[model samples]
Target: MSVIIRKSLLELIFSGAFMKRWNDKLRPMELVEVDKQGHKMIVAWLLFLLNSKGMDVARKRALGESIIEGGIYDYLYRLIITDIKPPVFYRIKENPDDYRTLSNWVLDQLKPRIMPLGEGFMRGMSEYLMQPEDKGLARRILNAAHLYASYSEFKLLKSINTMDHELTEIEDSFVSRLEALRDLKGVSELLNENDNVLGRFARMCGRLRYQKRWSQTPRVPETSVLGHMFIVASYSWFFSMEVGACRARCQNNFFSGLFHDLPELLTRDIISPVKGASQEIGDLIHEYENIELERVVLTPLRDGGYAEIADRLEYFLGLEVGSEFKATINRDGEVIEASDAKLAGEYNLDTLDPKDGPLLKVSDSIAAYIEAHTALKNGISSDQLHQALYRIQQTYKEKPVIAGVQVSALLADFD
Candidate 1:
């Protein structure tokens, strides 16, 4: 089947309007046998499309000519290139009068391609669509979509291997550690399962990125939720040591950071602007989020051998069951309001005491500042870093723990 498809693909490319029409009417997989098992069908189709018409090639080549002649080819090919390709289709569709059945076809086909690009493209598109005067925004959107599609496919290849093991050696090691942690007395059941622990922790870390206010930072790298978790956990451990805290306290802090934003896996990283609107709007959003968190995040964790762990974590985070421990740690890491803070704070930390909470805070601040300073040394501005350090210092000024720490001096090292 594949051989036949490959042999005919060249003919199809040259078939012009016929091939375009066919692609417009049906999915590429239905028209051709190039869809290889385990290989992405989209990539195969893209290869076919690219071979026939190079990216943004004028629609007047032999293949385009054939598309005009072949009714079936003309139908689907137009649907794909126009609407499904991004920027081009979306731009035209903005004027509803310009939209046709063909336009709808383009949207349906491209959805599969665009969806995999995830939050970055979604955010980027939202911003791009609002730029009313930028005539070039359409082209930029197309470029962005193309780049996103390429990156998504590349990441998919990187994440899994032929051995069929989804987790790498490093990830496997981490899973083993989680399993061991689950076996310990008083360990939560949620962290016991191999998949659940990783999924929940990954989600939590992703959410913490927003809470830590990194999302608003422009040009953040294409980081996965799990990537953020590892960094935060590492920072938590380092700060624990600097404070000469107990090993157990430090371990708890690490875990706290690891699971701080688990609720976000369900709630998503709600951006600042949307969240900061009128009180009534904010309350309505929160209500919707509460229902979603319970239905999605909490329920699944409980059912997946981590119910007890989830319960304990919920208690620790003071969301519901363990609401008693609700607290806020100041910049230097002192618990100021355990109860009210839990209800209002962005990140949940139900079980964490002031010692654990503040240590994580300091670590979070220091890590961010250090990263900023490093970036500045590499030619990025240090204004944000300076502001952050000042804010952190001010927040912790009254605390004896941070007294004489000389954070300004430490930051100067990066400069």
Candidate 2:
């Protein structure tokens, strides 16, 4: 029963939309290639969090010296530089004071798209880890992350010029309407402060471009783990849209999918075959990931008093939950109790079931299928690729739906 549920969930995580993310080209280079930006942004955000010690120190100094909070300024700066789309950014650059107003407008547009998942994870931090006084700070950080995740895709879209000319023009005009506010005195002061942390983190994320995915697959374009996460997150958002998921559910699915492979940063991309080599081996790998994640990722943040950020990562990555498949099902195929229930009972009462585990599983499988499919299309014949494609298709042969998504139809589109 658990196997069935796990299988279904994997299928959702690898859904066609997720896979298509890999195919989405990014550029500004000689090579006609780049991995999806959505995944890259997830890694970027994680890096930002990991490298935020300097920012935290700066914020502390500001508070002690009776200076205004520099944290908010740092947040805005990072968001503008990292996630703000080119079309909108050009406008924001022209008028920095309107940054607050324009940012809200941009977020509104991104709400139905990819920001919700990041938003949910941010909100999770405030709810679970932070003190009341720090909740506002948590929210500001969330806004930054959310904005980055949303606009991250535009880097690729603009590079490839994928959208129609008319649509591009419309987007440009829409952002240009906001008049430039001349005075940015407060913002300017904040911006003048040192931002070594942000710079270091941004550079670290940039290195992911060199950390190629599917290293064994020949004749395939190089993909970075960073890019893959963005794609998965975006795909999860699209899948949520397709299934008419509630706002909260959509956020959960997007974030869960976005950070699903985060442990790979410390562990590298440990391929599935090695993980599935044996039950004991799989369990051991999982154990190692948990340990490394805590040591290399979560512990430093917690020690630095950014426990909220660490907690949010654990939640989104399923570290806190133990299993990616959150629901317990019996042989009769009824949910006995979901992981969320256990969480709510143990933690905050406001905690709600994300109901996205199954969807994430499907998205995962779809992503795998597309990777195999793309390899095959490139004439890179590998037994593993062929078998993976066949296995996924075979597994879903009679499975028509999971989490309200038409499984058969989704697979058929790939066919």
Candidate 3:
């Protein structure tokens, strides 16, 4: 099915950046919807990685699709409800007729904007939203991830809110809810263990929420590196559908976009201008990033028996093939680079475990452009933002198509 792609749809997804998480409580740093969603997805994937030891590709794909689609639905619903307390929302959900009415309204609002994602996506969203009692493994994983992400944020605020009575209650609630999921395959193993590998890795990703993007310039609804990654991941998924990417290619692109700047978690967000100062400086920074990435992320995962996870991450980052922006695939344990044309043609099979690196680059750039453009639209302009937008547009101006999508035309739509 052909789906329309437009500015409003992408902007709708980006709007999550402005939706503050835990609005009623005091936070050491701002916790926004985008960052929370990003962290949740990361945790979900981490849990999925370990728990899905013997699952078939089809089942994995279905569950993965559910996680992604369910997340989108959750975000959209949260946006409409606008800071309703969980208890109150639960009350609303308890009334089947009322819940159905409310959910349908949400789908109505989302349909026009998200219909472009395709009929199946909207159908999944509607079905998932209307049926609130989904007890599948995918749902369990999402539930576990949700509590983990929220609990991680609670830790950040716990230091300052030590005396607040409600803080203790919230903490207990999070623990109880998470403990309830101990029945789930990997939840107990990881969460029950002290300073376990998955816990450490998830916490590392949570820290990305603190690393703000565009550090050199101020912008309205400031986005963190974590939030930016989520946007890129989201865009990559939608674009993958738009271009008819294979299952593995779509999965690879989404995850690659998700973790593209993960190295920045250690080094912080390095502005492009500083990196672009000289070729040597850029190379030095790249070299340093790889060193730190291996030492901190890969080494720990490998040591903890999550080497497959580590290796897959390395592949997504294109550690062996060069820049993460280069198209590549894994065939019988060998990392082979390919062109966008080949990815769309010969290497589209799932067994190749292909990743569309160039398409992922386009997703990354378009996400940045949207960030700058949104900031300007929100009336918090700076030369940095303007220059960033201009540079992206100029870069794509001569290229009408990129990774099977109309890159120049899409950029022109924003004009």
- Considering every candidate listed, which one attains the maximal lDDT? 3
Question: Model 2, residue 213: displacement in angstroms?
Answer: 2.6
Candidate 1 residues 168-215, lDDT tens each?
A: 642454345434433222223223313454234322332332233345
Alpha-carbon runs more than 4 Å astray in model 2: 1-36, 43-207, 327-355
What CA root-mean-square deviation does each model show from the true structure?
24.3, 12.7, 1.5
- lDDT assessment of candidate 3: 0.85
Candidate 1 segments whose C-alpha is farther than 4 A from its true place: 1-155, 158-216, 219-225, 267-290, 320-355, 381-415
The collision pairs in model 3 are none
Rank order by TM-score, top first? Answer: 3, 2, 1
Report the CA-based lDDT of candidate 1 relative to the real structure.
0.38
7-125 per-residue lDDT for model 3 (tens digits): 88888888999998877777888899899999988888877777777899888877777777777688788778778888788898899998999888888877788877788888878
The candidate that achieves the highest TM-score relative to the unseen native structure: 3
Pairing residues by index, what is the TM-score of model 1? 0.39
Cα lDDT, model 1, residue 26: 21
lDDT of 2 at 359: 68
Candidate 3: Cα lDDT at 106:
80
